[model samples]
Target: MKANRKLVAAAVGTAIAPVLVLLSPAGIASAHGYVNAPASRQAQCAQGTVSCGQIKYEPQSVEGPKGLHSCDGGNAQFAELNDNNKGWKATPVGSSVAFTWKFTARHRTSNYEYWIGNDKIATVDGGGQQPPETVTHNVDLKGHTGRQTVLAVWNIADTANAFYACIDLQVS
Candidate 1:
């Protein structure tokens, strides 16, 4: 039985070896999160309320103008699960936005969700979190155009250094 198990392990390792080779050192480093729109500040808002930008996949360094911020500032706790998955949220507060948020697990979030004016209309999923790395991130609020109340959340709680984001988006 042990010999059979060894053989199975070897076979699995061999199969996985080819797949692991494609992940560069940088790719491995990015297993935590990704930085979206490092230079651009304007992310589109559909329904004129739900706009987003500079989504960090694994809590990386975010850079923008002084007023531009994404996620909160703190270490991510295990309990901050339902918040924004390293992305920003927008809700039209007299053309701005607002939302309640918390923290989440590292590299565990499958995607993100947003609600514009009480209607949950968007979700950011598998375009980048998977292995291929060719996924894209964007949203279109053409159909559910309504009043928006940005609901932004992130992962930050009971952690050594809390992971956070600036919960604001430059809507267009």
Candidate 2:
């Protein structure tokens, strides 16, 4: 009888192990997304254009609560992205360019917004659908020139969160 009881306990542990791992922080961290084109700060880190910490491994995981304007996506683990002196490479772009996002986990999106400093230059309505593996938007940089940093926000439709990506650019 005791042997049967021990066997039952072991079976239960084995059954729940997968569920526990899925619900862990590491699991959720693996499901978020970030910008890849124009090569966002995190993306640059991931691509070795810049030296970074753990953010270099999970470039898509810089997600945070929505309505907040921050490059790190409010995650301290990725805080290095906010450092301007990290020698982040700026891609040369025209006045109008396509900014693309490579999503590892696509969520229902509310919108995509782009900013240079405090000015909002463009916004694209997301239509509340799961994005493709990659989404691209045409952003106008009309009066902007020289070295500039653009902040892109991917607002999630069903959650109080968003993903942020900062891209350095040399607009010509």
Candidate 3:
């Protein structure tokens, strides 16, 4: 009788072990980040500067697989960001611009890349270390002028994913 009770207890423990592991903090450490300054489309949406859909509530969650040049990180909920005709307000900037990023969950970072069309304008190395709540990068846009959509990517060090944002700018 006692042996049967012990066997049942062990079976229960085995069944619950996987659930505990999935609920652990270590198992759910995905990083969330987005560009705020220069007011990326997500930032503008979050701040109510522009009308948006579900992405306005979770601007920092525009994460997707790396090497993607998309503004919404290929997220269906954020697909509104890919619409260039949505009347997004462009920030006036100079030949050189400073972009500020805000992270809701900072993780070990790989690097940050800024792109204009097919051209990569700037890259800031992270050396695989965890970052602060906010980071700023100064990007040079000397050769490019007028309205441009700059795709910003935040590559994670330990993960195969990255966060993405797009800043609309009217360069003078």
TM-score winner: 2
Let me know the TM-score candidate 1 reaches against the reference structure: 0.29
| Collision pairs in model 3 | none
Instruction: Count backbone overlaps in model 3.
Output: 0
Q: What would the per-residue lDDT of candidate 2 be over residues 2-115, giving only the tens digit for each residue?
A: 999999999999999999998888876576787888899999999998899999898998899987678998988888889999999999998987999998888999999999
Q: What is candidate 1's CA lDDT for residue 108? A: 31
lDDT of candidates 1 onward, in order = 0.35, 0.90, 0.92
Deviation in Å, model 3, residue 123 alpha carbon: 0.7
Q: Write one digit per residue (lDDT tens) for candidate 3, span 37-128.
A: 98999999989998999888888999999999999898888899999988889999999999999998898999999999889999999999
| TM-score ranking, high to low | 2, 3, 1
Candidate 2 positional error at 39, Å: 0.8
Model 3 CA deviation exceeding 4 Å by range? 1-31
* Candidates 2 and 3, the one with greater lDDT: 3
Residue 73, model 2: Cα distance from true site in angstroms: 1.2
